[model samples]
Target chain A: MARIVVEVMPKPEILDPQGKAVAGALPRLGFTEFAAVRQGKRFELEVEGEANEEVLDQARKAASEVLSNPVIEDVVSVHWARES
Target chain B: MARIVVEVMPKPEILDPQGKAVAGALPRLGFTEFAAVRQGKRFELEVEGEANEEVLDQARKAASEVLSNPVIEDVVSVHWARES
Candidate 1:
């Protein structure tokens, strides 16, 4: 078994109020010094069967199609991690 | 400048309908090899100044205090990657 990690993030042009909200609250919390922050989604898929190129290809499809909205979001990448 | 990544995941016992929703939709879309799926938050913090321990520590504090909900979510880890 292996794991596929799909990272879905909002397009750069899209306004991320959630990230901004957290960024705004950071300085107040005394963790100042950061210029910007972007919040996105991380998906962990536990593959029960084989974790091969076929699975990787499907994972990529799932990442772009099911995990993210191309109109508003950008899937940074989909990669395989060792099964833990 | 550097980047700080904060990964926040819901507790194991917590219900993750979003992840389940995605997982449910995947098979319909022809990606049906995963046993389970979990979705969480991935935060990217771009630091303007040096990416030192001080900055890393501050980033950790920001990650835990502002980026994650201690009650329902668990911050998996905080780490630094090369500035891109």
Candidate 2:
């Protein structure tokens, strides 16, 4: 079965407290010369059955509905890679 | 400047409560036959200076620091996509 990966993250214009917190930890982590850091989500799902349009459609719907928060985030892109 | 995109996600064996919550909403959203969903992150950073070893090194450091949490997550890959 092919693995479908989804990435969910806040839009550039949005304020990400989680990312901000992580950014704050950079100095402590020994990182310098960096400005901003944004955070988001990555999902890996195994699509059972044939990778047909119906399955893909259902997967996309599920992603928008349950997998990601579209209100505060955008750029929900899905990629397919071989599982090997 | 190139956009370095990083995708962070919980390990496959790990339980993703957030993804579970989203997967639970699938049927209501018209999705069926979907079993589980795991979630993670995507960061698009405009890397300054020449995209050389130094820039890449610093960028990777920043990613591990402020952009992603390596504790509960892994697969922190950074892809350099031309910004066009």
Identify the candidate with maximal lDDT: 1
- Candidate 2 lDDT by residue in tens digits, A12-82: 78899877876667657776444566777777766666777777666676667667677877646766745
Question: What TM-score does candidate 2 get on C-alpha atoms?
Answer: 0.80
lDDT of each: 0.85, 0.68
What docking tier does model 2 reach? medium
Model 2, C-alpha of A29: deviation from truth (Å) = 2.8
Write the residue-wise lDDT of candidate 1 on B1-84 in tens digits.
678888898888999999898778878887788888999999989888888898888888877778888888998778886455
Q: Model 1: clashing residue pairs?
A: none
Q: Compose the digit string of candidate 2's lDDT tens values, residues B1-84.
A: 555677677776778887787667666676765566666767665554456667667767776765656777774587775555
For all candidates, the clash counts are 0, 5
Winning model by TM-score: 1
Where does candidate 1 chain B have its weakest 10-residue lDDT segment? B75-84
Instruction: State the displacement of the C-alpha of residue A50, model 2, in Å, after optimal TM-score superposition.
Output: 1.2
Across residues A1-84, which tens digit of lDDT does each residue of candidate 1 receive? 588888888898999999998888888888778888999999998887987898888888888888899999998868886455
lDDT value for candidate 2?
Answer: 0.68
| Prediction RMSDs, each to the true structure | 1.5, 2.6
